[model samples]
Target: DQQVKQNSPSLSVQEGRISILNCDYTNSMFDYFLWYKKYPAEGPTFLISISSIKDKNEDGRFTVFLNKSAKHLSLHIVPSQPGDSAVYFCAALRGANSKLTFGKGITLSVRP
Candidate 1:
């Protein structure tokens, strides 16, 4: 079974609108959660992250919320822009090794 899951295969949003992506995890030991945006030919770039100790974390237009009790997390983008279109991956890290476990990723298209 996959430890991390992104149920949505894709998401489409108009420019200046809001986009929401969801992620769920089965591992309770996961303490660090992160969101990464990847383009067609490049590697994923870090977006936002939240630690299990915090309920929410935000940076500019991106925000990440973590619910430890529910083993769920969500990423929200406000005023989505065309450049924001990419594949978003949810990742989790735990313990000293800090190995990352990533979700399947969701393709996001922001229309102008």
Candidate 2:
């Protein structure tokens, strides 16, 4: 079974709007959640992260929220910019291991 799921494969938003990317995981062992953003022809780079103990974490225009009970997590980008358009992946790690399990990336398009 797929441990992580991104129900929506893609999301589009106009510039200066809020963009929300969501993910759900079935494994209860996931303790640390991360979000990665990837540009065309580039490797995915870490964007933001939220630990299972915290409900939310914010950095600049990006924020990540985790609802452990629901096995859901979301990334919010405020005033979405065209430059922010990319394939975003939700990842989870258990017990400080180097390996991370990732969900299918969700392509995000920002229209100017």
Candidate 3:
């Protein structure tokens, strides 16, 4: 499953605000680097990570929403805190080899 994640490499946000991140695989030709090679195709070993609708699944202060129709997904951090600063990643499932393609990390910076 190829996805468009539009989050920039760096994000700065004030604490206690909403932080939204997006990524797109269709642009910039970065897709090639994200691919992995695996031998012998097997059935999907595990189901997709669906927790809180693949999820618009939310955990505490973080919420993730996947929009299949728009070919994208977004991660929302509400009331963003300084401790939340970190690099984040996105992944795509390669059904042929039952492998996953992971996008590079996008750094998040929160200001207090």
Candidate 4:
């Protein structure tokens, strides 16, 4: 069974708006959460992450919120832009050197 899931397959947002992506996990042992963005024919690029000890982490326009009790997490992008259009994935890790478990991914489309 898949431990991480992204229920929504896609999302659309206008330029300069906010884009919110969600994810859920079934493993309680996961101690770290990460978000990655990918474009067609390219590898995923790390975006942001949060440790289970913290509730939130932010970088520039990207922010990640984790609700440990609920086994849920979300990524928020403020002032979304056309360049932000890509496949976003949620990933979880148990410890250093451990492989990351990733969600299928959600495609975000930013229209002008």
Q: Pairing residues by index, what is the TM-score of model 4?
A: 0.97
- What's the lDDT for all of these models? 0.95, 0.94, 0.55, 0.97
lDDT, model 3, position 101: 57
Displacement of the residue 24 alpha carbon in candidate 2, Å: 0.2
Candidate ranking (lDDT, best to worst):
4, 1, 2, 3
Model 4 clashes, total count: 0
- Residue pair clashes in candidate 1: none
lDDT of 1 by residue, 1-112 (tens): 8999999999999999999999999999887999999999999999988988999999999989888889999999998999999999999999578899999999999999
TM-score of 2: 0.97
Scored by lDDT, the top model is 4
lDDT for residue 98 in candidate 3, whole number 0-100: 55
The digit string of per-residue lDDT tens for model 3 on 9-111 reads 7789999999876655553322221211122343222212322124356657766676654556676789898876666665565444655556665767889
Off by over 4 Å in 3: 1-7, 26-55, 94-98
Model 1 residue 5 distance off true place after TM-score fit, in angstroms: 0.2
- Order candidates by TM-score, high to low: 4, 1, 2, 3
Flag the better candidate by lDDT, 2 or 4: 4
Tens-place lDDT digits, model 2, residues 25-89: 99988879999999999999999988889999999999998998899999999989999999999
* TM-scores of all predicted structures: 0.97, 0.97, 0.64, 0.97
20-73: candidate 4 lDDT, tens digit per residue: 999999999998999999999999999999999999999999999999999999
